[model samples]
Target: MFELTAALIVFLFPLAYSPGPGNMFFAANGARFGFAATLPASVGYHVATLLVTLAIGFGFETTLQRSPILFQVIKWAGSAYVLYLAWKLFRAHAIDKVGEARPAGMWGGAVLLLLNPKAYVIIALMFSQFLEVAASSGEVIAVGWISSVFTLNNLVAFTVWTLVGGQIAGLFRDEAQAHLLNRVFGSVLALVALWMMFG
Candidate 1:
């Protein structure tokens, strides 16, 4: 159990903190909106993360393993959604613009997590690596610990990235600079989507 807990911390710390679509989206929204405005989406994303983690821990991995095509479909769908987000970010007007340039909301964040191929894969891997079949009680306890760790780590990571984005926004006070930064984020998001689809 100690070994499992240590391994989970080592593995999940980097995975949760690393640059990913979810983190990037939060950062972008934080910049476009503000940290306070991004909270609802953050909450939604973490809720989805917890639910997905629980699902994977409780035998959903077998279901996924049996249906490779389902994985492919999800990958494609997730990629498409990411691309759509990229397009939206790319076309985002000045932050000061009053109409139609709103930041992503709670549902947007939840949907992003629901469609995130990486999130599914990571959760599956975590369970496969840490869960034991015979030790039912221990497994349940481990899963509870894992879920808590994952949620806490994700909250910290997302908040830090959001703060960074807000700082970046401060740096890019000029409308043109902000626009350019938004386009850069859009391009990065597109690249991430492509990587998800093909890598």
Candidate 2:
């Protein structure tokens, strides 16, 4: 149990803190819409992610791993969707201009889970590295324990980032600064998509 706990914490720390498309998008939304508005999206995103992790741990991962073409297809599709999100973020109204609420609903978040390569890698690695550490009898319990802990950690980390973005949203009352911020984050998303495709 101690070893499993330690392994789970180590994995959670890096996976939760690392900047990815989800984090970036959440931050951007928080900046555009206050944390209050971004809360649903954040919740939906992590919930969907947790569901995927659980599914993968249970055996869906084997199917994904065995089918190279299917993996590649999902990967490319997800990357393309991210790129589209970047464009949308870039085109959003200026910070000072009154804008509608962000559209990242529960389904949107679920769809993102499918496309997020970081999620794919983390799920694959978690099962490979951490599950191996457990005894055969400990496998099922370990997967559930580790996944629940990591999901909680992930939610907290991204919520904090979203709150920070909401706070910073006020700092960019200037249209120029807001535009620059959007461009920069959009560029980052584009880069991430390229990396997932080629890296």
Candidate number with greatest lDDT: 1
Model 2: runs farther than 4 Å from truth? Answer: 99-101, 135-137
- Cα-based RMSD of the predictions, in order? 2.0, 1.9
Q: Which residue pairs in model 1 clash with each other? A: none
- Give me the candidate number with maximum TM-score: 1
Residue-wise lDDT of candidate 1 within 4-122, one digit each (tens)? 66777788888877878888888888887879989988888888888888878777878888998988988889889999999998888666667877767778888888888788898
Lowest lDDT 10-residue stretch of candidate 2? 94-103
Q: After superposition, how far is residue 98 of candidate 1 from its true place, in Å?
A: 1.6
Point out where model 1 deviates above 4 Å: 1-6, 133-137
The lDDT of model 2 is 0.78
What local lDDT does model 2 show for residue 119? 84
Estimated TM-score for each candidate: 0.92, 0.90
lDDT of 2 by residue, 1-199 (tens): 7877776787678767778777777777888777777767776788888888888888888898799788888889888988888888787766667766365877777777777766877887887877777646576787787678767877887887788778887888788888887787678778877877777
